[model samples]
Target: MNPSSPDGHYFSPEPSVASDPRVVDVLLDGVDLQLQSDAGVFSHGQLDEATRIFLDGVPSPPAHGNLLDLGCGYGPIALTLATWSPGARVYAIDVNERACDLTRDNARRAKLDNVHVSTPQQTPADVVFDAIYSNPPIRIGKQALHELLATWLQRLAPTGVCYLVVGKHLGADSIAKWLTSQGLRVDRLSSKQSYRVLEVRRTDREQI
Candidate 1:
């Protein structure tokens, strides 16, 4: 697979891998999911630990409204969000074309019509999310990660919230402080297995 970015783990703009589909079976909230994956996507073999932790750590999302699965890899978070909130529109955004293809396929296999897989450039600028979920691409480095998070976090509605999972060694605490300093309210919702689950929202809604 052609490495899209320097760190090189499926943050590619266009992956060189052939359209060979693979399978990943994951159990979210006791529901088993067999998602279509590919060689060039993140955690293509199976669900990654950080994502599993994020899924387990987060509560069921709001019943309705638009939601985002930032840096979606084969649509796990997006599909899960669609399953958990049937009335919501789940946007699965990824920079990798191959990953986007896999995500679209997985959404179809899951029989979820609500999942919209797209690249960052394709997502509407005015679209605001009710909630955002990610096991973010921290390996992309601090500067890029900050830019990515800032871009999406700014798209959060006034009452929107974002659930993110980052490993302790990957600067979870520092990232939280950085987010807070940017005028977002970041709270540690859970810390388990060397991973931190951060709950983020607009500063004005901090008390809400």
Candidate 2:
């Protein structure tokens, strides 16, 4: 999760802090990876607990389809998805340009060409995701978080599913109810360490 910064939040389009890069080692799906991270981004020096739990709880991604790593901070989720599903396209999007750059560099370092790193606006509008995995920015406040989820959740393919890990204290249950009110099916896949893993699917063929 992104901590508050004196200059700006990690969600800022451009962070004001100077870059202090570091390498973060992450083990996902029993595969070890060394990725690049930097200041002014979420979990800069290491994998945050929420993301680690998220990775552990979620199932393997689709073998060949468009996959989305929403709010991808420094490429952990996106890289793992790309690594495991070489046939699939992994889109890693974040509002922070620094985060996007790091994800791009990390993807290159990992030699995963299938991962596409971009800002939310830079992503192609025509593309639809087969699955979306995220540890959403819950601290962005309830309204902004709701808007962000609504925007992307609408982009899910008819049968697409979204797996999100949110802290129970952060209102995971409330978010699930809100998603359901938006005409999506929400299921609690698991809960660990005060975090809830929610599986969201469109209730109908129509866009939510």
Candidate 3:
């Protein structure tokens, strides 16, 4: 673990593990999704705790346009969203190029043609999302992670919402408060492994 990396998780632009990553199967919402992950991606070995909490709280298949998994590690949430909501498209984005590639492979193996995996900069700037889901990278420290979340949360469509998973020990309550103060309606949807699942909605719709 490199102390230089905040979480001792090397999510470098160019990671040292050069060979193609190995494939691993993850169970989400009772469905299996095959993913390829190595050093640079989040939860390289298996499903991370926060994501399990988020998956446990995911209500039902959302009904339309695009659902996004920001900071998607290897397409589990993205693939699950696509699988659950056949009518909607799923976009998986991450900063790690290797992670993006792994997501693409996972989507391909799952036979999901509609799931698009891309780097943060590759997504069209004009695109708006119907819903966003993430098990945020909280260990990156509060301020940086907040900035990351704020950027994507602001991209939600008028009727959109974001589902987030953050551990209580990692300041989930403070984040919920922060989102609420930002004029986004936030609800604590579930609690597991001392993690809080948050549901966020934009406030502008109150006028409608």
Best by TM-score: 2
Cα-based lDDT at residue 57, candidate 1: 85
lDDT at position 34, candidate 3: 72
List model 3 lDDT by residue over 25-69, tens digit each: 777665777777776677777777777778868798576798899
Candidate 3 lDDT score relative to the true structure: 0.80
Q: Work out the TM-score per prediction.
A: 0.92, 0.96, 0.90
Question: What local distance difference test score does each model get?
Answer: 0.87, 0.91, 0.80
User: What is candidate 2's lDDT per residue for 122-190, written digit by digit as tens?
Assistant: 999999999999999887889999999999998999989999999999999899999999989999999
Best by lDDT: 2
Q: Candidate 1, TM-score vs. the true structure?
A: 0.92
Query: Which of the predicted structures, 1 or 2, would earn the higher lDDT when compared with the native?
Result: 2
Worst 10 residues of 1 by lDDT: 1-10
Tens digits of per-residue lDDT, candidate 1, 1-208, equal 5555443468877666656677888887855789988777898778998998999889899989999999998888889889888899999999988889888988888898999999999999889899999999887889999999988888888988899999999999999999988888889999999999999989784322
Query: What is the alpha-carbon lDDT of model 2 when measured against the actual structure?
Result: 0.91
Error of 1 at 150 (Å): 0.8
